[model samples]
Target: MSSRLSSRRTRAGAVLSAALVLGSMLVGTALSTQASAAPAPDVGIAATTFADEFNGPAGTPVDGSKWNHEIGDNVNNHERQYSTNRTSNASLDGQGNLVITARRENPGNYNCWYGRCEYTSARLNTIGKFSQTYGRFETRLKMSHGQGMWPAFWMMGTTGGTWPNNGEIDIMENVGFEPNTVHGTIHGPGYSGSGGIGAAYTGPRFADGFHTFTLDWSPNLLIWYVDGQEYQRRTPADLGGRTWVFNDRPFFIILNLAVGGYWPGDPNASTPFPNNLTVDYVRVTNTPGGGGGGGGQITGLAGKCVDVAGASNANGTPVQIYDCNGSNAQRWTRSGNQLQALGKCLDAAGGGTANGTLVQLWDCNGSGAQQWAISGANDIVNIQANKCLDVTGNNSANGTRLQIWECTGGANQKWNAAV
Candidate 1:
């Protein structure tokens, strides 16, 4: 249900910067890694659409009523105090920048639960508000320094009401002392910080300059980057339990500067107090061809084929995506829950429940064998295979093999899906 999106809009005739897919850019000695390409953007699904940055002239200011700003909590970091105002702490630079200032102040805000703030600074979070299912999330920002200064812009699951269980995406995190290296990490049931699945890309000292950090989320896998340089590649196993949980629910963003906690320990006297995390802007774009499958037009068909988007042509051929042309070849008569095409019923290969079961067509048995349903505006599944009728990794290549496998939430699961 959730996915990462990355696309840009341009004027007529203007050459757009095409998105670099999951396996697009090769790093070090390679051209690309083996991460599963995320599902292409399915704009049809409202939850997976575009987002306007906070109250900038770009669009509307993400209604404050929707986002809950977190402050005064030690969270995990042990630094100073927490403030939301742009005053002495954090603020928005009209030029598209978010500045979070950490300064030495009297311990003013307190809560016996996590102790009080001794130093005054700023931290912002998108915990209770907006989070897209899938899209590119990038922020141009500069960091501050000090052994105790821990600043991060990340995302967490909005459900299950817990950490790791819900999922955590640390798009950017840095400590005051380690002024040069920046990190990107994912934490969930199976993975956490140190022992969890995490990696970092060393750009110039992030604390000294501003850089853009991005994550391309696709149904197949996760990819990370710093100024467009590939840094990490991950599969479902590395994503942990959050893999299923994250895709199943909505998530939100959080921008905060923690004083100290588990990762970066307590701050010392040498640690500078008034440090800052300045963000230039946050922009999101939508991928066009619904996730996984490559795209094609409605080809051979009979009188405007309805209920038929990606069905097979030749007899005994595994189901494949074909162009709909209102022709007999593409049209199917719907009988309640049944889709009759080429005189064969859709059935699961070997009627297996395991993942990756092949999908085939056989004589309709009228049993659950021929039932079908679609969840997102563009995702389909057979009642039996529980596997989606995908277009072979959405490869758009003609004659790509169509085999049934357990559902893995890749772009392939997403069909031109008329539903």
Candidate 2:
């Protein structure tokens, strides 16, 4: 995301306390054999497309063929750490883990264009060596805890496009100030940087042990989970006027531990040194299980577009017939049993099963109200209602409301996808 964070300023003190508490707790756990509450990633070995268990000897460098180090200072988030390729900053810990250590270092150790640098860390990416179009991306790791610590598991498009325009998927990001919370975000033109579309997950302090951060990505959706518990989902409809640039494009992964910056602020005297982001493993898989389909225009009834009236993303937005304008409001994606537009599912209002039931936009759930299927006759039918998607009163004029009606083989009941 972007560098600015005016609101985070007030949360700085709380973050410091959390950092200290988390560090203490983690040290205790590491010293004992007691089981941790943190959960490891459920990496289906049979479905793995890529995996790194970091099983080399302690201090061994990362596999050059699988990753590249992003060396720099302040990078894009105005971070205070300089990322280097030093094994001291990133290496196998001998215990089947990749340890990315952040330390207080003098500017003499590393050249910096922003004057003296007091911190050093590591940033690794899979830009040229590995990239994926859609699948599951996950990592098991214990985050570093400190006032200025910033650790992330994210991805960027590998198409050599500019920031935002190319696309950025933050699978999981945590600022030391919020050690108990992790964020999942998507950055694209018109909705990038600090303005990226996303949400946060808050629970146990993940630094105490290892926890899994995962992204179930498809052509039209991104579902985030922490230790297998779903927390957030994002789609093109969430971007408002922005373009959805994630479809069918390859994205490479990145792992980094940064110190200081605008979001978490600079480290203070109370901040701990040698903070480490310990990763148990990183994995990728290609089994697209939660319904996969290309997002595109949906047409029916005289070739009119199935549109979101007023381009509204709000719940209960009317699903109407309109001239095809190729707007996001007309863009639809199929996720599981639901037909989604504007991040909501098309629903037969009130779960109405009879004819003349109005169709509207509703929050996506696995409910039968949102379930639909294409009939052999090419009708868009609501499965639960057993009725066809039809233009109200058979009127093809723009702005006509859509409804569910008994199958009548009318032209209005027939649908097509110009996907």
Candidate 3:
């Protein structure tokens, strides 16, 4: 969600600034749109961690335990709406749906970024109520329509960090101007705002009926689906050396109907008021392996373990392959895109990208040099460098230091990450 305030208009041929605000921090807002219409892959279900069916009597507010109303005019998005906590803006339809209405009236006569508020809507989030790291999050909903209307189902990291750096997953976002297109995007460091990596699925008008939007998230993969059809996927490799922050932390869900922002522009004379964003349900289920936050031995060439030299937590300590003695240094933990042992991250020395750059243990500073992805080919890849974690010289010596080298599909590059 480009929930940032910006006066720069880009609806024509101009460019939107990359310094738009999301929450209280600045971020970019350009989406690299990829189009796809593939069928959704068969996915197995697991234990559900969260679910909201939106069941209640008509006109009643949502369950307070499940959602928090984020009130106030969102100046960050340069929106014309004042998000209210009243049930009049958000209520159950008695038929198993939560409706968020955006009206032209502002009963409070609230002031906005552009003087008087022109609209009133509702924004709800599950920040403290629930959060998950890696899972399949899905929602079935019907979007609001008309120029200037923006409806979204998205997630934001709970790291309490600045925008983009904490990461964001846009499961579904629709602007009324393009009734048949919905976007799925990921915003993070070096790739926020107008530079966000995303894709658009264009088909039937989303505001005409209900559709299921989904995000299947794992350690290094995120796939988007609309109504059981796959549209786009993202991985660390797609970030172009940027930090992949999605795997390291838990994220909470957000639902809102925004009115008139940089992306959707202002409402037109023909635009409809009191448009509704109706949601039937939202659910989250655990994916296999559960993505990040796992710990175990990372075994590799000659059946040796990836070990931190001397089990030291000191920064810049060489990381090497050692005999499988089951020592603390051999115990590796996956935290987001990082591999840690003895409280230090496995890092590409000095953020190096050239082959032969030594691998070492460093302070976890959320750098791309410390980010790694274990691929399906059993290759442990350095995300920033796009290189494989190779055992130096293909030697299995107890003290053979590891290095980042071009992926050669050799046994020296293969790894069995128990993390």
How many residue pairs clash in model 2?
1
User: Which residue pairs of candidate 2 clash?
Assistant: 2-193
Q: Mind giving the per-residue lDDT tens digits that candidate 1 earns over 1-419?
A: 01111111111110011211222212233211214534423322222233323334322233355444455544332334555443556555444455667776655545423555566665555544456665556555677777877877777767764555676777878866677887777766645445456787665777765565666566545666564344675667664445445565555766667665555666888887576676655544333121221112222112111222245432234544443443433433222343444444445444443343434555433345455655554445565545445444444444443444444465555454331
TM-score of each: 0.52, 0.60, 0.60
lDDT of 2 by residue, 1-419 (tens): 34544211110100000111111111221221212222211211124567786887999999998988987775446677778889989999987789999999964466554667778898898867888989878777988997888899998886646776778899999988898999998887777767778899998898987776778787788888765456788788787757999988898898989887778887888878889999977878774432332246778867899998898865567888899987768877544345666545688776767666677876544457777876555677777766677777667889887777666677777788532
174-286, model 3: which lDDT tens digit per residue? 98899999999998887887788999999888887767677878888887766545568889999999899988699999999989888898899988987899998787766
Q: For each candidate, what is the lDDT?
A: 0.50, 0.72, 0.76
Candidate that beats the other on TM-score, 1 or 2, i.e. the better one = 2
Question: Candidate 2: TM-score?
Answer: 0.60
Displacement of residue 404 (Cα, Å) in model 2 is: 48
Superposed model 3: Cα runs more than 4 Å off: 3-45, 288-419
So what's the TM-score on candidate 3? Answer: 0.60
lDDT value, candidate 1, whole model: 0.50
